[model samples]
Each structure stands twice: as structure tokens, then as C-alpha cells.
Target: MDTMRDRFAPVVSRLLDEDPRVAVVLAEIGKDGFAEAMRRHPERVINVGIREQLLVGAAAGLALTGLRPIVHTFASFLVERPFEQVKLDFGHQNTGAVLVSAAASFDWPAGGYTHMAPGDVALLDTLDGWTVHVPGHPDEAETLLRRAVAAGDDKVYVRLSVQANRQGRAVDGERFLTVREGRSGVVVAVGPVLDAVLAATEGLDLTVLYATTVRPFDTAGLRRAVQGADTDVVLVEPYLTGTSTAAVSEALAEVPHRVLGLGVGRRELRRYGTVEEHVAAHGLDARSLRERIGGFVGAGRASVRA
Candidate 1:
């Protein structure tokens, strides 16, 4: 099975072939994968060298011309580095572009803090009118990418990560899927963390809700899952901890509930290690998650910061 980034290039290549209105902009980060795409559609496939600002600015310029631009780069460079452009060029201008990001969180541990982007989703949350997609498997990534490209002049961000689940769920880029139905509590697994969440909550009577498109926050689905059930909710994401806790709170504002946000934490791990090592260090592995989730649900009041 290919990684999400591994599948992005060819998928966009096919999209370029199918849609004349679609365009791609890069900043020399993943240009090698699009060699064939560049050769085939030199005019549409753009590589703006190392200028992250130029990458987004160019894509916005393309969008101004009524073309749906798809921009790709590392999360740090794509969202953090050129955030001003993302705010102004896309958001302020009322122009929509599909911003696809790779290397979510600490996917590439050796790349150091500069390459990691655990705060990308949180930062984008400050802005309005942005649809965020975090796909756990390549199939889900492909589905979200296709939907983003097909979307007409809408600001969409599709987050791609190296970490993935063992299998892909049927994701429609809309609502959350109910993996398990229970009355104890609800665990919302976003992107790649479904398998670990499943392992952690094994034997526990809890509703495991899976999500691909997280920005919309599937309020109705979550309400239905917790209706007459345990009002306790837990969000296990692959990005910064508590990224979606606010959304969850707003979703259940009318009801009395408690939410525990779990994901990459604010503490920085300077040492460069393997991905698995980072997962363990951040307490995101199955063992740590099981302990934290069990404590939270059992005790009825516990704060587990990822």
C-alpha cells in the first residue's frame, strides 16, 4: 500500500487530464513525483521553486482567472510559512484553492521541528470558510482529493500524512462513520488513528466514530451517537492536542458533556527519532491511549493531554 503522499501525485495527474479548469502549484518540495504531470501539462502544473509565498500567490492568481488551483507542499511550509498568503490571497480575496499538505505532525521525525506541522489545523481554524480533510488511508485521501478538486472555487485543505490505518473506511468527506455503538461514551477518531483507537477501546462499550472531513465537525452525527448515551466524548487526532476540542464543545453546547482532546501535544520533542518512537513519546500509541481512555471513561473525570 502506498502512503498518502505517494498517491497524491498520480491522482492529481489524472485530475489534470480530466479537468481543464484544474491547476497545481508546488514549491520544489515534491516536484520529482510530478515529472510526468509537468511534461504533460506544463502550463497547468507549476513549480515556483522554493518560494512558499509564491506557491500560494501563484495559485491564488490562477484562481482569480477562474481556474481551480490545487497547491501542494509540506504542512509547515504550506500553512505555517505562507499563512499570510493563505489568509489574504485565498481567504481575504474570496478566492478558493485546494491546499493539499503532506508530512502532517511529526510524520518525518528526522526532518526536525522545521518540517513538522502539528499546529497546521489549529492555525487554519483561526480563519473562516476553510474545509479541512484529514484522510487516514490512501483510498480516503484519493476520495477527499477528488472531491476537493471537483468543488467549485471553494477553500479546501486536504491534510495527508505518512501514518495510516491498516485498512480504509468508506469515507464520503461529509459525515462521521459509526464503527461501534455503545452507551458508555464516544471516541471520535480522526484520520490515521482509527486502528489504535479501536485497539485501545477494545471490550469497552463505546461508540467509535471515524472522521475524514473534520472542519464541518459532523454535529448531527455526534449528537445522534450521544443521544441518551454517555455524554462523555474523546477526540483522538493526529495533529495538535485539543485542536478539535473547541469544535466538539460547540457541537454539544446544548447538552451537558465532557470532552478529552488527545493528539500531538504542545511540548516539543527536540530529539530526532523514528515515527514509532515519537508516537510512544507523545503517548499516542495503543498502550498509552488505552490507559488514558480507560481512566477517563471509568473515573468519569480525568484530563488526558496527548
Candidate 2:
């Protein structure tokens, strides 16, 4: 049950030590792990306490000065609260930055709705040229973080969750990787939800696709995967429901297809206990996923056997 956050600290410290142009901005989230990075490069590593707005604004300022800044905080604090700063300071300014977020979606359910950020991706979609990466495991997250730092002047958002798949897989960030092949439908599992999606579609006849990068979606890959198949695309994301519905529709506009989007449902305002409990409450558990996916692929009765 180790998290991407555990792997993130050491990587950030190493980056800070290696690159003088790279800076890390903290808003009171992972101060303990990044403490050494701050100690090594006090000029580059910055902490603004709990002020998320200034946290984002400071990163933007650093970007304006030809320095690449990696900002970290909770999803709610990083995106939902300082949206204007993200929109204007980064988007409007046309400055590039790597925004790293922990406790994405409902990872911190005990923190309540104030901490959960189901709509962060949707909000970022409203902006332009922002690359979003939802790494499934620590290895994937590390790859994406390195890429983001190497990618100069390109806005990147890395969403990290506590849940992880059993193993780590190398992510290319440009296309979807096929995990399993079937004849029924194509189930695209985004980031941390790969394990749950794998469990749900264990015995079903469906092609499973895993994506670490959601924005700049691989339309070509998806189109090729569903070339002669039943055009049934099911996108299972960790963010809000239907976050990629528009992109999926745009990608498959030439073909006739039915799409089903699944993630954190927005209807419920109440708490659903622990992270596992919240996942089940949103009908994202293996059983619920089996029922929904099976129903979507026309395997209603057969899905129950799993």
C-alpha cells in the first residue's frame, strides 16, 4: 500500500540537487521529505506555509524568471482554491510549470469534501496547453516527473493518489498501453484505477487500456485499438465522472460509438468513511465496476460469475 508520495520526495530532492534551474515550491504538504532539498538549495526550494494562492503565484513568478518550478500540495489546495492563479499566472502568462498534487480525487476522504478534488481535471481542461499526468504507481510517477522537469516551458499537472496497482509499468505518456485483449469493448483505465479496473474485467471479454497521461489523449491509439471492434469505449478515470468524455467523443467522431465515463460521482455531498469506503460508495469497487462494465458490454448475466 505504498504511495507515489513516498517515491516523490527522494526524486524531487535529487532533481533539486542536480539542476540549478529547477525549483520546488511547497505549501505545507510534504515539508518533511523535501526538507533536505530545501536545506541543500535554500535559494531554489521555497515554502509558503498554507497559502495555496501565493504558492501558485510564486511558481509563476519563478517561471517568468526562466526557472522551472515544481509546485506541490493537495489537489483541492493546488487546483480548486488557486484556480485563478493557475489560469492567469500560468495559462495567461504562457509560462510553463509542473504542478504536482497529492491526495488526488478522494485519496484523503477523511479530510472531507474540502480536501477532495474530483473536478480538478475538468477545471484544467478549460485552460489550454496543460498536460495532465495521472501516474498509477511510484515508478510511473517518477518517469512523468522527470519528463515534466525536462519539458521546458510546457505546463504539466501530475496527480498522485495513494492507491496503486500491484506492480509498476513504464509509461510513455503519449499512448495507451493494452493490458488485456478481448472482443467485447475497450476499457481504458486511467492512473491509480488500473487495479480496480483489472479486477472488474477479469473474466469479461474486453480490451483493457491503461493511460498515465490523459490530456493530449492518444486519439490515434484509441482509434487503432477499436478499428474493427464494437466501438464500445469505457473510460475509467480517477477524477470526476465524464472528465474525458469530450475528448473521447472528438477522437471517435468518424465512427459510430457508445462511450461510458466512470469516476467520482458529484451527486453525493456526504462523507463515505475511508478511501476504500468512498470508492465503494461511488460504485467504483470491483463488484460495482463488474456490474456497470458488464452491463455496458452486454454481458449482464455472464459478468456476475466473476
Candidate 3:
């Protein structure tokens, strides 16, 4: 299976050929993949080298001209580094651009903390009118990319990652897809972490909801999934832990519920290790997840602390 970032280049290239208003601005990340597209439409494919701030600023400028601009770079550089530019140039100015990011969470641990961005989704959550997509597979990434490209002039962030699931799930507009059904509780798995979530959740009598388009939060789907069942929700995200806990709370505000948000911890891992090591250390592997999730749901605890 190809990584989400691998599929992104071809998808954007096709978008460039199909739509004249579409443009991609990069910060020297994934430049080689877009070489053919660059040759075809040099003006539309802008590479701003390592200038992360300029990458966003230029994309916003292009948006002001009525062209739908797409910005690409690592998650840290794309969202965290030029966050002020993303806010001022795009949000404050009422401009729109598709910000695509690679290396989700800790894809390249050797690149150091500067390149890792497990908090990108949480950071974007602070902003308004930003649509976020975390596809579990490359095919889903392409589907979401096309949707974002034609999704009007609203801000969109398609998070591409080196990590991916073994298979792809269906893209159902902007709602979560129900992968399995049960009565005990609901486990919401976001992006590439779906496979592990499924593995950990097997035979647990818990409903599994796969999410690709997470910005809108799929409140309706979430509410529906928990109806007449235990209202305990375990959110397994590829990014920071507890990032979507608030959204879950809001969705089930009227109903009695307990939520356990599991993902990358806030504490920085000082040692540079492999992604597998990071996963184990963070307790995100199937064994750890099963232990944590099973304990949480099996304890019969009526409430989860915020």
C-alpha cells in the first residue's frame, strides 16, 4: 500500500490539469514527486524552498486573486512554524487555502522534534472555519483532496502521513463510517490509526467508527452510534491525546457519557527513536491500546474526567 503522501502528488497533479484555478505552493518538501506537474504548469506549482512562512503567505496571496491555493510541507513547518501567517494571511484576511501536511505525528523521528507535529490538529482546532481531513489510506486521501479542492473558499487542511492502514475505507461525504457495531461503547478511530484501533477493539463488544473528515466532528453520526448503548467513547487519534475530547463532549452534551482520548502524549520524548519505539513508548500499539481501552470501558466507570 502506498503512503498518503505518495498518493497526494499524483492527485494534486491531476487536479492541476483538470482545474485551472487550482495551485500548489510548497516549502521544498515532496518537490521531486511534483516534478512532472511542475514541468506541466510551472506557474501553478510554486516551490518556495525552506521558507515556511513565505509558503503560506504566497498561498494566501494567490487565494486573494480568486485562485484556490494549496500549500504543502511537513506538519510542523506547514502548520506550527508559520502558524501566525496561517492565521493573519488566511484567517484574518478572509482568504482561503488548502494546507496539506506530511509526516503526521512522528513519521520521521530522526528529523528531530522540529519536524514532528503531533499537535497540528489541536492547533487548527483553535481556529474557526477550518476543515480537517485525516485519511486512513492513500485512496481516501485522494478522495478527500478532491473534495477539499472543490469545497468552495473555506479553509481546509488535509493531513498526509507516512503511516497508513492496510486497506482503505469508503468516503462518505463528511461523516464517519461505521466499521463495526456493538452495545457496550463506541471507539472513534481517526486516520491511519484505524487498523490498530480495530485490532485492539476486536471482540470487545464496542462499536468502531472510522473517521476521515474530522473537522466537522460528525456529531450526528457519533450521537447515533451511541444511542441505546453505553455512552463511553474512546477516541484513538494519530495526533495529540484528548484533542477531540471536547468535540465528543459537545456532541453528547445532553446525554450521560464518558470519553477517553488516546494518542501522542504531551510530554516530549527527548530521545530520537524509530516510529515503532515512539508508538510503544506512547502506548499506542495494539497491546497497550487494548489494555488501556479495555480497562477504561470494562471498569464500568460512569464518568471520565475532562
Among all candidates shown, the one with the greatest TM-score: 1
Relative to the true structure, candidate 2 reaches a TM of 0.96
Please rank every candidate by TM-score, starting with the best: 1, 3, 2
Candidate 3's displacement at residue 122, Å, is 0.5
Better TM-score candidate (1, 2): 1
- The reply for model 1, stretches above 4 Å from the true place, is 301-306
Higher-ranked by TM-score: 1 or 3 = 1
- Mark the 10 consecutive residues where model 1 has the least summed lDDT: 297-306
Can you write out model 3's per-residue Cα lDDT over 145-250, one digit (the tens) per residue?
9899998888999998878899987885499999999999999999888989999999999999999989999999999999978998999999999999999999
The best candidate in terms of lDDT:
1
lDDT by residue for model 2 over 25-104, one digit each (tens)? Answer: 99988999887777789999999999999999999999999999999999999999999999999989999899999988
RMSD of each: 2.7, 3.0, 2.2
lDDT score of residue 122 within candidate 2: 98
Query: What is the clash tally of candidate 2?
Result: 0
